[model samples]
Target: MSELLAIAGLDCSYGEVQVLHGIGLALAKGEVLCLLGRNGAGKTTTLKAIMGLIPATAGSIRLNGRELTGLPAHEVPKAGVAYVPQGRRLFAEMTVAENIEIGLMARGKGKATRDMVLGLFPRLAERLNQRSGTLSGGEQQMLAMARALCLEPEVLLLDEPTEGLMPSMIEKIRETVSKLRGLGVSTILVEQRVEAVLAVADRVAFIENGRNRETMTAAALRADPAAVKRYVGVG
Candidate 1:
């Protein structure tokens, strides 16, 4: 139960426009830690900082006690972190298999790793030859997640994963997250749905106005649904 990914006093910005201020998070191995806040509350910025996609001007991001603050964005995955951004970014013209192959390139994963991740999303398996851009919204999300899993990451950063998905797709995404937990993959989940947040989060941290607000056990938060709305911006 040791911390696998840790972020302390994180600060991020876009050309001097700071979006995060002293954000901190700790994700233990095999645990799901959710980040809650309103739009533009620095939730996604925290995740990007952790992934090295956005530079952190101040703070520490460590994985397994190893410093990751200055690691290159491309090297972050090799260091055991995989990120699935909110948009499901994939090569529009690439086949599903090709997209996954690109993910495999991060850590030099091969057929076994490819097959394992593909197994997680059988729909993606069925569409291995299909172009990613032509897939449905839900399927694109699946591919994005499967692609990240190809890195066999110790920590997974999921940003609004269930957004715009159907009920069935949302359930599938939740099921996949549960499976990842069983597989000992820690996750930092940024979600919009209160039910989904409760379903997967072992703990929830509130980020407010670009700073660390507080953290609580999911059970504690679930007992107070009104607080859940207030904290996560459910309105």
Candidate 2:
């Protein structure tokens, strides 16, 4: 199958401090690829580069055969990529429904998408009118994800969706992501939760010193946690 998204020889820098180096990735339709690395390993930079949030010093980004390099960040979303950053950035002052409404404001998706996102995360339905800032950590994460889903994106890029949630909430996010895959949404997940990420990912990419150290099937990583630990700073 042709890739939904592809990054080849990607390199990035923060000022003169170089970050990502020769990073490459490909995500097929309905497949989830997880990127694992220790802090400062450039995992987030890879995502930013692909989204055009940060300019790539070198490399190519293609979405479904269209060259995306140098496209403005805003235009990248129009090309069918939706990103949920690490912090679960939500409009704190806005209500849950209002927050999701923000996501569709740019795309002009109608009420049907709202209903779809609500159906996928029923908790958000009950909290529709509630202030998003008051939501617990887990609810906020769901709200963040729900907002992204409202876009009905062809490819989803998630950065640490389970970063600080409790174990139960982590499980909920895991199941939600699994359902997204079942729904045929291709995803690239950058996460710190080793066990949680591996559980849902179809394939794994381990990064070390700003490069792709290895790419293997999820089952292979599960069978050999030690290898991942050595690369990602945890087992």
- TM-score quality measure for candidate 1: 0.96
| Tens-place lDDT digits, model 1, residues 1-235 | 5778888888899996988988878889899998889898888988888888899999999899999999998888999999999898899899999999999998998999988997899899899899999999999999999999999999999999999999999999999999999999999999978889888899999888898888899999867767766766564
lDDT of 2 by residue, 1-235 (tens): 5788888999899999889889999999989999988888888888888889999999999888999999999988878888999888899999998999988875789899988889989988998899999999999999999888877888888999888889999999899888989888999999887788778999999898889989999899878889776887665
Steric overlap count per candidate:
0, 0
In candidate 2, how many clashes are counted? 0
RMSD for all candidates, in order, please.
Answer: 1.2, 1.1
lDDT of 2: 0.88
lDDT of each: 0.90, 0.88
